[model samples]
Target: MNRLAYHQGIHKFFMMLGLALHISKPVWKHLVHLVDALTTKRFSGTLTDVHHWSFHPNHRTTLSHFFTKSPWNEERLLEKLQEWVLRQIERLAKRTNQPLFLSIDDTICQKTKPSSRATHVIQGCDWHYSHKDHQMVWGHSLIWLMVHTFTQAFPFAFRLYDKKAETSKMDLAIEMLSSLKGKRARPVYVLMDSWYPSRNSSKPA
Candidate 1:
């Protein structure tokens, strides 16, 4: 199915759930349209279907503008979304005997243009011969904590680390571990590469 149809279907499904009655149906639909446009690869467009709902032709709407106009506060929305996701996960976990596995890893995405938002990010030391270019390039790595159960994988946390940063990947791992310490479904094991060895690391595997 096309992205627009898929997104429209999802919005309809969520509306049927009746979580909160305070939000207007039109507004909720617009929010869903905006979110799908921003996050999904298949739904790429500068102007969203939201433009169709607006009467003024000259006005253009962006994701940032949608958020600003949204009645639901960002923090509360995030918290509620997280709670719903966790509930769904717990339901699935109860159906299986296997324990959840958490994996931590970092990756670098090389960018040609520098970002004003990239200040204080550390530069990378030459770890290996560059495959993309002959010369070494400054790279920033981001650490992510992901959980795997029998049927699904959930990403719980992410942190960015530069080579010149004071904190190490180990530090980021520790932070991720600390964050998950008291979860209802405690992870059975944490998997990591040789860069994070079991012998020397303070975090449990």
Candidate 2:
């Protein structure tokens, strides 16, 4: 598709998505610009990068505040997204007689070590052992859950692994799974790495 047509198509898609999610039109307009910037090839996932790449006239600060200060409830958005994905996949899985699959994994987003003199470092960033690198890495950690059928996959849910929080990685994994309880009619096979198959996790769900 031509650039203009592609942009228009994306705009319409997000409009329909926003309506389904019950986002106010004004918030959806700004949200669409942010989403547009995110989908761009050269755009990095940052407020500054989003503002630079987006076609909207809003300043960078406005974009930042749109997240930090906006009254919109992100939890609501996520819940709606998960509900929509479940509906589509559940329908398709039944039609194709495909058993659903759920996978859980965690990853570390490594960031530069903050200077010793720096008083305020990024919140929720800490040193965590990287199984891939076999060493401690300083960054935020995240755990994600994805659901899939034979032909398609969806990011069902995720949780940031906060060391300071009361929850363990296993607890977070179980929590994400718990949210999906009683929501699916199809048989789902849960998949995880060797690290996740502990005594607690080995128990029948």
TM, every model = 0.57, 0.87
Best by lDDT: 2
Give per-residue CA lDDT, model 2, range 1-205, as digits (tens): 2345655776687655555457766577677677778888999677887877766677778877777787787887777678778888899999999999999999899988999999999999999888889899999999999989989999999888888777788888889999996856889899997657676643111
lDDT of 2 at 102: 93
In candidate 1, where is summed lDDT lowest over 10 consecutive residues? 49-58
lDDT of each: 0.60, 0.80
Q: Compose the digit string of candidate 1's lDDT tens values, residues 109-156.
A: 554445568665434522322445665555545778886776897777
Q: In model 2, what are the clashing residue pairs, if there are any?
A: none
Q: Candidate 2, residue 186: CA error in Å?
A: 1.7
Instruction: Please report the candidate that would top TM-score against the real structure.
Output: 2
Question: Candidate 1 regions off by >4 Å?
Answer: 1-31, 42-61, 64-78, 113-140, 181-187, 197-205
